[model samples]
Target: MNSNQTEQGIRTLGVDIGGSGVKAIVLDEQGLTITERSRVKTPQPATPEAVLNAIASLASEQGEFERVAVGFPGVVQYGITKTAVNLDPQWENFNLGDALSKLLAKPVKVANDADIQGLGAIKGQGVELVLTLGTGFGSALFIDGKLVPNLEMGHHPFRKGETYEEQLGRAALNKIGVQKWNNRLQRAIANLEHLFNYNTLYLGGGEAKNINFQLPESVVVIPNISGLLGGIKLWQN
Candidate 1:
């Protein structure tokens, strides 16, 4: 809709790369789309090269996009990953934005996967704490509209020699029954509330969608698929 964003065609597309898959969506200036979104398997090993190649291939199929944004599952420093938890060890110390940008030959932006999803869920709200319940727990703190990157709070010990992610994530959900699961969820929320004082807490990602029990007050459940729209905003900024 304006001069600056016209080059990327993301005025036409936004790509969300998750542990399981890569999602691509086309959007207008208002972040609304004129076409349907697309998704494909996220490469395993989830290494810098494999994921980058997958993104490049996906981008090629969609013709051309104005800009591309990827969500990495790790602690990101200046668009390069300083640490990767659930992904390939090779991902650690990788320059993802630069790598992907070179491959796509376009403007490419990367953020901790959950942060991008979190930003997508807040509908572009400047600041909020987002806890994404996926393969591992993804937590991101957005301060004054900037994503601070990896916060790995999931690995913090909670109980019984298990970390918070182990107690509350999907793997743990199946292992723990409803009563016990909600108990941990409650404690996790309490901890987050105390730590961040985030006015809004958005719970997104695949597992958040299957939440069966009642959520605590002020905790919002956002559609997991909705993150694609948020990815669009990354370039707009």
Candidate 2:
């Protein structure tokens, strides 16, 4: 047991369901990490059932917790998944919160993966935008700490009739090489700055580590860990 476990005696499990993997961590009431985050590769076909099973296995490693907060890679409204993105089309309209809660035997809170990430990364003031670069691009917009969920900015048309993800996602980076990919990111940043005029922009996700250029003062790149680290905040709302 750590200081948080001894002091507060309360903890919650934070789960991040990604396109490539699922990660979970135990966080005390004070928002301190209590366990080394556990991870499992997202199963083949990446259906709701498969991902839920994987998350359950990850949660089991943490023993027990009061509640579960999940950040899923799609549009989530009141625990229902509205979009699938990189996941199976079957995930659409799935009541993930109810299903996961039933499986884990605990209350569950579900939100857009990027929205959950922004909850951790934002300053809770002014206009903020978070972009997650991974198998696909995930985006969340916020103003004064309030989330504007399900923007799905990645699918919108961008350069040469390609969606932002087509030019900037992991597959794009692997296909175009880091230098060109980084250039694309720079341009994307410029475009977003013009479009949203956000006070701050946070870049996260597995591929954020690949950024090689200096970002503008308004831009910040957060660790990939923010994905799971931000999970606790889901219950705060």
> Cα lDDT for residue 36, model 2?
84
Runs in model 1 deviating more than 4 A are 1-12, 123-127, 143-146, 177-180
Model 1 scores worst on lDDT over the 10 consecutive residues at 1-10
- The sequence of per-residue lDDT tens digits that candidate 1 reaches over residues 95-192 is 88888778877777777778777777764455588888877788877777777667778888977898978888777877876667777877788888
Could you tell me every candidate's TM-score relative to the true structure? 0.84, 0.96
lDDT by residue (1-237, candidate 2, tens digit) is 655443466678999899898999988876678878899999989988899889888888987688988999988899999997788999999999999999998999998899888888899889999999998999999999988979999999989999999999888999999999999999999999999999999999999998889899999998887887787887766
Query: lDDT value for candidate 2?
Result: 0.89
Best by lDDT: 2
| Best candidate (score: TM-score) | 2
Model 1's alpha-carbon lDDT is: 0.74
